[model samples]
Target: MGGSTPTFGFPRELRILSSREYRHVFDSACFKVHGKGLLALACPNDVGHVRVGLVFSKKNARRAVDRNLLKRLTRESIRLQQHRLPAVDIVVLSRRGVLELDRQTLARQLHGMWRRLEKDVKRAADAKTSA
Candidate 1:
């Protein structure tokens, strides 16, 4: 476990309800990369802070307990790498394998996904600046 409390965690930080704010992101969000257990979607938001929407659908991960656990692990991974990410709303969609993966595997998968997203975000930002 991390020594310091993680800033990007559930109840305290994640956003998951269906609303107009979410719809705004849904239409604009672009998906960058996907791995066995995860898919990352990025959307530019008007808010100053980055918001996360984590989904572990019942159709994929059956048990509520298992789904919650996977969400928590993904949350921690994001919290640790929060500094490297851009200021965009990120949604991580979870798969069944996510529940079974080891901590290292989970971290590595998420980190790789984050890295991909960062690259795309930066490239787009640069294109806008150059244009």
Candidate 2:
């Protein structure tokens, strides 16, 4: 994590509640994309900042540790990219193949996902505004 907190992080009191929202970030919450392994839910924080959620399931990663590690990877990646994204909630789904990815590859993929998501969000906003 940066010396400064990423633009989006759940407040200490809200992290658990955020995960309980159930809606996927892409479909429900506003979002931006990064790489294959990384997806984010973006919603304006109450103070107009971003918040994040990480999802890793045993069905996808197999082991509890693997799932936990995947969540950790997602957290790190988002923390690194948080400054560039707007306020929104993000939920990263862990595909089965994610366990096969090395750390560096995962990080790279996360960055790419973020770039794609930014473009998608902008395009959607533009479309909505134009409509």
Cα lDDT tens digits for candidate 1, 1-131: 78686554445444545666567666778655687778877787665555677778997789898788778778887777776777788877876576677778987898898888888888988998999
Please report the candidate that would top TM-score against the real structure. 1
- TM-score of each predicted structure versus truth: 0.80, 0.72
Q: How close is candidate 2 to the true structure, as a TM-score?
A: 0.72
Worst 10 residues of 1 by lDDT: 8-17
Q: In candidate 1, residue 105 scores what lDDT? A: 90
Residue 79: error of model 1 in Å?
1.3
The alpha-carbon lDDT assigned to residue 64 of candidate 2 equals 90
Clashes of 2: 16
